[model samples]
Target: MIFTGSLNAQGFEGWFNKYLLPSLTRASVLIMDNAPIHRKSAISQLVEHTEHQIVFLPKYSPDLNDIEHDFSALKRKRMYASSDTSLDDIIRDYCIT
Candidate 1:
């Protein structure tokens, strides 16, 4: 289940307690994207004790996160063909490139 709000530690805490735990009866390993917040002490503690398995994908691999592709594509679409001369200009270029 995709947790739509902020992907921060607190958000994950709620997600874990609300959505993830209730489905524990199923039989399958949990495959998760490599996100620092997901590896927090609170979450790790809970996951470690549960029978539900978890796998963190390789670090620095954007291929593992589809959201990365979507965001990158959004950036590409927001940029312009003209070269940027300033940092803000570059940022704006990404807004409409």
Candidate 2:
């Protein structure tokens, strides 16, 4: 899921169709932040056409986004982690079962 450059609407469209859509095991909610690319009319149309639902988080509401807490913890861990520690290890440590 890492891209070399900033994501534009077209790139997101391709990724959504090629990757995200195919990975769904069942109908689910795809919650996203209020990024411009995520707000595209085409993106909404694509999701609406599927059984899955898409929801955008309220603007400036990091407390409502669970990932924000994980990211904050990750940053704290990264700050103290040894140089030899791998990112995968850090993420695995913080991963919820």
Note the Cα lDDT for every prediction shown. 0.68, 0.85
Residue 63 of candidate 1: its Cα lDDT? 90
| lDDT digits (tens) for residues 1-97 of candidate 2 | 7779788878888899889988999999988887888755777788877899988777887898899998999999988999999999999987852
Whole-model lDDT, candidate 2?
Answer: 0.85
Flag regions of model 2 displaced more than 4 Å.
Answer: 61-97
State the lDDT of candidate 1 residue by residue for 2-97, as single tens digits: 446567777777788788777778655777776767764676666786777767666777798888886786566546435545646655755575
Number of the top-ranking candidate, with TM-score as the measure: 2
Give per-residue lDDT, candidate 1, residue 5: 52
Worst lDDT run of 10 residues, candidate 1, spans: 78-87
